[model samples]
Target: MSTDKGQYFNDLRTIQANLPTEYSRTFGQMIVHYYLHLIKSSHTQKANAKGLKQQAAGILQEFKRKQSLRKDYPATDLLVWVAESNHLPQALPVTSLLKEKKYRVTYISNKQQLLANPALEGYNKIQVVLPKRGIIAEKQVKEFEAVVSSIIANTNLAIITAEDIDTISKAFREYVTYTRQLQADYEKVITNVNPKAALIGYDIPTEGRTLTDVLNAKSIPTFMIQHGAMAKVDGIFGTHISKTIFVYGEVSKQVLKDSGTKADIKITGAPYLDELMKKLHTAGSKAQGKLKVLVAFSGPGHLTTENHHKKSIEAVMEVAKNHSGSVEFYFKLHPKDNRSYYTAEMEGKNLTNVHFKLPHSQSNDIFDWALFADIMLTGASTVAIEAMLCRKPVISLDLTGDYKELSFVKEGAVKLISDKAELNTVIEQAVLQNFDAFDASSRKAELYAKQFYGPTDGQAAQRCAQLIEPSLN
Candidate 1:
């Protein structure tokens, strides 16, 4: 359990590189992206290894279960969509536009639960297809198992299995077979459709990358749309693999450009942002409240390594207890976040004006609260950028001081504060509209919004569609 992150990441890469050649060539590319989220507050260096072993087992079991259930895909030329829930909003408008232009499109949702999500209601009709005639061959699984066992026995990768090697020796074996089978599913799907061009949102996720890599390997064009703002991280996130990556505007284009990315980065105004701006500009001013403050949580695992996720809420609510009548604080949880924990925390406090924004039925959801809030607080989340697009003042509690790469903060569109005192002072000023601070900040936010989101004419989806239409030719 070392604090040396450099050593930890190095060991991670070594384990990934040592994966069975077949998988290392495919799934290994994004293993770090997955592991970065796994190393939450409840992890240690030992726990990290144990977690990977368990993850491997789960994957293998899932694939083995699927061996009995195989289906064939539709045989036809098509347009493929690999957008998950997070990517749905950015994808829906553009996909809709393409369909309107008479293109054959099918959305292959990765998660079954997404079927119930309100966003996909009308766009849910999909091409239920598969080219494979049968389930996983027994020989494929056994061969992978043998290769992994042989490699683990022959290699120097104690870093991956050191914590509980004997108990989970089959872990690596399962992992290798799972990736192989997973890749084939994507390949078979692509073979069935022979897609004109496949589109996947911000392609660092292993599942998305697997699908796109399969397409890329087949020489089928692929597009990785800008799902959110860029963050500063080691290669754990935002490594593009698609034939082209569509960014929102100049700022994100520059961020990816400076990252030394090999993929072509093009400026395409965000599809979701276009709709939000349409709603925002047509909507009136924020509703009446004393000092309307929205504190949004970016979930517990991603950037909350030291438990800053919980503490930030404590800091905000702790201070809110002081000015009961003058200010109201709204707590907005990320869609995947637990509601019970925050509900309990606010239960017996007897605090006034503290409320939780429940999930919205609208596709992108948080636009209502983002519009309602006069000021916002968060840590290294794209929510800050969305709030900036709404021209709301944003404050981030950089408790660790390592979030300097947060885009809005870097551009001076958001205020960066270190602790509770500053949070209180900023909230007070934001409430009083001290010397046109709100007006001045609003103007600054809009100027930068043009840079962050490009044209507000609501033509982003058209622009994106035009760029993607060429691949069909």
Candidate 2:
């Protein structure tokens, strides 16, 4: 098991060196990271001991051998994703592979069709209908409860929560209700499924929350998969307490030291970015003409506190109005945001130069657009990391206060734009800047990402799979 664990991580070293530079540590957070990493490592040690005793090494090796030989063997179950539309695209490759590996696939949408879309053949989907009259919170919990009951009975639970803690953008207090409901619903689902092994995509940003309360309370062996640059969010301390944490590069392993998170942190490069890189390369040569810029706004979170969606839309609209034909702006809305927000700002205006993109578009489709864009704009979306992976320039706009905590912004991979006027000037300069030779700072940042993310070779998922299979009993 130890040898398997070591081998799993060794594959990730190359990936770490390839991480983007924009994912650097900010001041004051290093100490906390180190301490947290230490704690997490200790927890992993304990979990490993249990696995070692429960399943012997000989059987584990045999399982691997069987996995190799039985490529055509059908998986016993399927993973059903009933998530929002934006998040759905990210899971596509995973779902696709699961099917190829012989596992059935199912995807659920929050709205629209009830009988599941035909395009998702062999994949099952259920529409989430809410009670029309009740409070939104009550409706969500009740609806989730029904789904949880059905899923737990039919399939092995494949839990995927980007982060355990949900934030409220309005008043800090408003977060309490959503947070509580999420916790309650998640707990109910996990309890019913009684998952044998679970995967955590990233470290949980836990400050006051307890891992045992959110997870582990039921003793589920969670396998953590590092989703992006090794940036820490709140409740990360709790992540240190997870049974095991998987990472992609050495830089991320080092980041745990700074964030004070200690898990048995293993390098498993992110599959999402890996696939993106592959698609970019296969698309043929890089851009030849005017740099296309895609501007994305991640809404209603720590950065856009107090429903600044209007302000954000106004800011983008102002840019569209000003730049119209000079610079083509592709606006990608956050999955969580309502389309009404975009319609409210863009409806009657009839702006042809600007395209406002919604969720559900293939991630690759969007990436295809982003690849040609000379520059990119965003308000704290991890898409910045994607931009770096694509070798495109990016700017992050922070309307609210939490920009400092963002790793890429701190590393200067992204420029901070606080207001509409400042954003306008920065966008103009970035788009017009000649790329005859990539900027030195930009090159340096890319080198930094190599360390932060691992390899740019585009096999993050394969690397992650090797890292995980060994550890699972």
Candidate 3:
């Protein structure tokens, strides 16, 4: 292995050491062990290093072969970059609507699995290749090195430790290096596709940000589609990358405005949730007998702490003890959360009525869960808004006492509970189907839905398509 590889491994070790205990225990430990083994084996045996290189080459060759099989379609007026499978639903509708307007469309994605998406059937699908490490040139290397150095020098040592600084520098170096490599490929694709306009969903870290930069350099008008709730701390939204941003509602538009974003903002609701919300509204109120509560669990990390998880379980168990056979609890785990961690956490707890629902796929319809649930509970998840869209009462378990400023709580979309006593009272009211008893009214939920999600009349896709069409000309 090269000296740079060894240094990278050392940096990973430094990062692993400084990571929070919960993160290190759950996920970061595996990454640390993988790099440790790779570095150790490379030093021990040259053959092992050769074998690892061969394995990577084999993976790359297979990827190229699959990409070669994709049929090339003529350049289109619009190019839609699908970053994640979750974004496909939002992108697909806009692309489909564009096709109806006689505009040719091409779809590109880094994840090959998305090519099989039924929604992407009629569109052209192209697989994106992320540049491998060590492919960056020396000139680019110096440029990125300077950028990393400046970042490190500017960082406050009081708040960030030397180890943290080193780890971040190393990570950013890799990001810049890979991004430079991917930029060349993206430039080539854009030149070949020659789209008059491009569409992307959210520009933050990784591929989306890099792609936005490339599109801006090429003078292509790129529109950013809102994917989810925008927080105040999400500084990436304020960057002047895309030409325009299509947000879900006026609230999101204002958030970007307050953040001093340079892009033009338009309210188009949520394209992906539009149809789902329409269907849910048409289905009317579900027949209720027993109290059905849906608990949306946040992924383990800064969003939800171990203490929050423990206390949430304790509070829910207490509520269950009182209601017993009259109520049922459905615990929905976040896509990134480990099912085993939640299962182990609930072990030995005598709660027969509580059931766990693990995320099966990116296409899993959470709206169905919202439809049946009379009330939803979560710590700080976007699903609270989804539940409110379905007219279901939302209860935020603020056991950690840190989520006082969450958008749902601030907007009165959810009832915040900080203790077992509050949890019991909220659950009791929810069970009786009299959430208004606790001052959590249906009118508040309705207003929140409108302000947060705009009009969910199944026309957001059309609005987005219309917004992108004029830019193409």
Please provide TM-scores, in order, for all candidate models, with all chains considered together: 0.78, 0.58, 0.78
**Which whole-number lDDT from 0 to 100 does residue 98 have in model 1?**
80
lDDT per residue, candidate 1, 275-392, as tens digits?
6676777543555658778888676544454456666777787778866778888887776567775665667889867877433433336767788777777877778877877667
lDDT against the true structure, each candidate? 0.63, 0.49, 0.66
Instruction: List runs of model 3 lying over 4 Å from the truth.
Output: 1-73, 135-164, 231-233, 282-286, 305-324, 357-363, 432-438
Tens digits of per-residue lDDT, candidate 2, 1-473, equal 01111111222222222323321111011222222232233221212223654557546644553343333322223323233343333345445555566544434233455234454666644332221111236554444334333433443322311121111111112232333443454454444433344444233332112222355556655455554345534333333445666665776676666655656776656656655675665542345444356877666532444355577777878877777767667777665556677778887777776766523465435576666566767776767766776677666666655565666666666656778898777666655664422354366557656666776666655654454443333
Please rank every candidate by lDDT, starting with the best.
3, 1, 2
Of the two candidates 2 and 3, the one with more favorable TM-score, higher being better, is 3
Q: Model 1 off-target regions past 4 Å?
A: 1-23, 27-30, 37-70, 76-78, 116-174, 231-234, 282-287, 358-364, 433-443
Which prediction has the highest lDDT against the true structure? 3
Pitting candidate 1 against candidate 2, the one with the higher lDDT is 1
Question: How far does residue 84 in candidate 1 sit from its true spot (Å)?
Answer: 3.3
What lDDT does candidate 1 reach at residue 339?
A: 73
